[model samples]
Target: MEKHVSVKMINRFDTCSSWFHHLTNKEMSVKRLYRTDACGNRFCPICTWKTAKKNAIKISILMEAVKEIEGKEFLFLTLTAPSVSGEELCDEIDQFNKAVNRLFKRRNVERVVKGYIRKLEVTTDQEKYITEKLYKRKKDYYDWRGLKVGDPNPTYNTYHPHMHIIVAVNKSYFGNRDAISKSEWLEMWRDCMNDNSITQVDAKKVRATETSNSNAVLEIAKYSAKGSDLYHSEAVFDTFYMALKRRQLIVYSGMMKDYAKKFKNGELDRFKKENEDEYTHLLQSVWKGSTYDSKLRELTQEEMEMYNERAKFIEEGDEVE
Candidate 1:
């Protein structure tokens, strides 16, 4: 990260979550606030894990709610296209996204799948199409491939961009004659892509089991791209940065859209309170959960003295790390 990001970013990472502000209300309920670092991208393992976990929770909420409705079916779908060179990655991603849009718009797809949580994942493979830094990408704003005419990043690999979608439909979808079988899914994808040769897809009905749901959710909500791929080389990192920087990795549509919007807008009130930082102080918190364990009551004489000293330093602009 230091090599790729600015010095300011490095400094932010250094102090991130180092001193969490613990806030207490009149009721003595407490919540801790951790500072967000500049390294909030997928490259940061902390942020990636947090994001994956958050998405899992969000999906769980949606799925659990959807399951309450009668006659709902869930399908885990994987759609793929052939691997592309780094030089063509951006265009390929654009095309893939457009193809997905077209597929969703098709009458057959829209008629069956009422709701969906769509996620895009990109993986790199060196074994199949392994090569050196031989291909020069059309655009390299950072010149990650190096300035020298012959010199480039250490290695290069082909990229596979695919979709992991979880779609919900009515129960009749399984029995309907026009139901989307594996071959039908492939046909739809192939037609949408306008490529007859491209035919890689995996679609399966998800059993309404806790383990099955958990597995499907994890597969869909896990990191969009691997951290290993990002750190492979400057060239590879740059390719990812250009290809995915501003793109939405996960999307919620149709029936799922309202739930996602509710989730995002804090209809889920815990989110607003939990994520918002009503920064208080270097809280004298031995307080555990909502019970207000130890920190809620009056402090001992020694504890009071320590708190005073700390508060004094803070007021004097001499904060102790």
Candidate 2:
């Protein structure tokens, strides 16, 4: 007799029941949704690109907004540290800002120095992988848009969440030419990273090889204006809704069936122990209180196809407006 392979069927309604039961009876529900469709390829890539482009445009606008102030020079400085606990990371950023601000005041250059610190938290896993990859390859990993081949690798090993300080130096001292040399800026950055304490860490003069191209920036800007409107369009919203519905159906039919079998076989405890945290979090994110509904009203299939076509054009760098 030949051994047979058996395929199992999942009940969608049962999956929902299990999810509901877990939510009502579990000790604690997960607080965060680790999985999202934001990265799904089935989703419009143009919409994704547009969102990023819009953000860049917004930042540029904000930077230019402060440019009109008389006697001010913009300074862009990045502060980095080794990856640590999340709370500690946040504290380090706060301390860095305070130290940098104090240093500016103590220097008393007599120009109105005003600035803000934007903290970017790098998760440990991502930091570790990036650091290791850079170390092994001896290459500096610039932003996606700025990436290039054959660059010297960053020396830092650990993922340290860091802060970017956009300082506007008073014109009376630094001058309007943005006269601060890269070395001077790096020293200040290193000092701030060290929490103003003396350390053996040498402030290496790393030249920024990346150059900003206005054409690339403008191209991004143009796509962003088109993408934003398309994303909120009825056609796009319908596609999103359909995808979400399909995902929900698959999870319920397949995942719930397996859970029920284990529960009946007195193996539920073992399975639960292995995936309780992840399952709880998923349920909380998907069906915690409110049912999932389309944010935009229904659209014709033709409109949906058109939105997707526009998205394709944007991704290919074609002229889109």
| Among all candidates shown, the one with the greatest TM-score | 1
Model 1 scores a C-alpha lDDT of 0.68
- lDDT of all predictions: 0.68, 0.35
- Candidate 1 structure quality by residue, lDDT tens digits, 175-264: 788689999899989999888877679998777775233777997878878888776778887888788877888999988887788766
lDDT over C-alpha atoms for residue 268 of model 1: 50
TM-score of 1: 0.68
Tens-digit lDDT string for candidate 2 (1-321): 011111221222113322221111123433212223332222344334544454344334333433432333444444455545433544554565466555555453223345432323232332223444544443333553354444433322222444344444454434435355555555665565554432222221112221122332232233211333234545433423332322311111122233334444644332221222222111223343556421222224564344434333122211223
Model 1 residue 100 CA deviation (Å) reads 0.3
Error of 1 at 38 (Å): 7.4
Clashing pairs in 1: none
lDDT of 1 at 321: 30
**Candidate 2: global Cα-lDDT?**
0.35
Model 2 residue 272 CA deviation (Å) reads: 53
Off-target runs (Cα >4 Å) in candidate 2 are 1-55, 68-73, 85-87, 108-117, 123-132, 136-158, 170-179, 190-321
